[model samples]
Target chain A: MKARVIVSFKDEVLDPQGLTIKNALHSLGYKFIKDVRQGKVFDIEIDGISVEDARKYLQEIADKVLANPVIEKFHWEIIEK
Target chain B: MKARVIVSFKDEVLDPQGLTIKNALHSLGYKFIKDVRQGKVFDIEIDGISVEDARKYLQEIADKVLANPVIEKFHWEIIEK
Candidate 1:
């Protein structure tokens, strides 16, 4: 199975990096752009794991390392190939 | 219309940040994780614009600011709300 993890800043958190990108876009004449939010994607290959097992493992990963729960949120999905 | 822009490193580009995240996951016991890739998502609201027009505008944004064409790629879609 393959898994994909997407991690993103919580709604209330300030995203300076995202802001910087937004500003850069504005300067480059993309005046219609209203906001920019930055996030991460992790594509992992987990062979022989059930979807439930993969989800459980990814949740632990997110809780322990992939995200700062205080300011970030993450979700994962298992993909069968 | 709303738009979503997804930006990512080109396939040949090395993603150190993604590697760092993968290492962190390994440390946290997600031993099954094989690889990780990092990317960015931008959601923008563009009022009253046709999808074709929005796509054209976003292409310009990607070319001029959202990505380094030599190392990154980006695509966008307009959303009606």
Candidate 2:
């Protein structure tokens, strides 16, 4: 099975990279863009774990190594392939 | 409206960071893991654009500034909220 984890900065955190991108977009004539925030995704392939165990395991992976608990948040979905 | 863009490496590319994380997982006992790949995402908020125009604008943003087309692929979805 495959799993995808998305990690994003917490809502209140300052995002300098995102702000830069937003400003650049504005100069590029995308004046309608109001804000931009950036995040990460990790795609993993797991071998032969039960569906129940897979969900638990993926969440553990996400929480432990995929995201920083203090300033970042993460969630994951198992992919059927 | 909002748009989320996901950027991922092309399959043939070497992913050193992904490898390092996977090896760490191995040392921590996730031996069932076969592969890991890393990517990025951008979340943008747009003000009062029509749905059709928003989609087109987001695609251009994704193509032009959100991703490196040489080694990465990007896809985006507009959010309703």
Which one is best on DockQ?
A: 2
* Candidate 2 chain A worst ten-residue window by lDDT: A72-81
In angstroms, how far off is B27's CA in candidate 1? 3.3
Q: Could you tell me the TM-score of candidate 1?
A: 0.81
Question: What does candidate 2's lDDT look like per residue over B13-69, in tens digits?
Answer: 899999999999999999988999999988889997898999888888888888889
Residue A24 in model 1: shift from native, Å?
A: 2.9
Residue pair clashes in candidate 1: none
Off by over 4 Å in 1: none
Give the Å shift of residue B16 in candidate 1. Answer: 2.2
Cα deviation of B63, candidate 1, in Å: 3.1
Q: For this target, which candidate reaches the highest lDDT against the unseen true structure?
A: 2
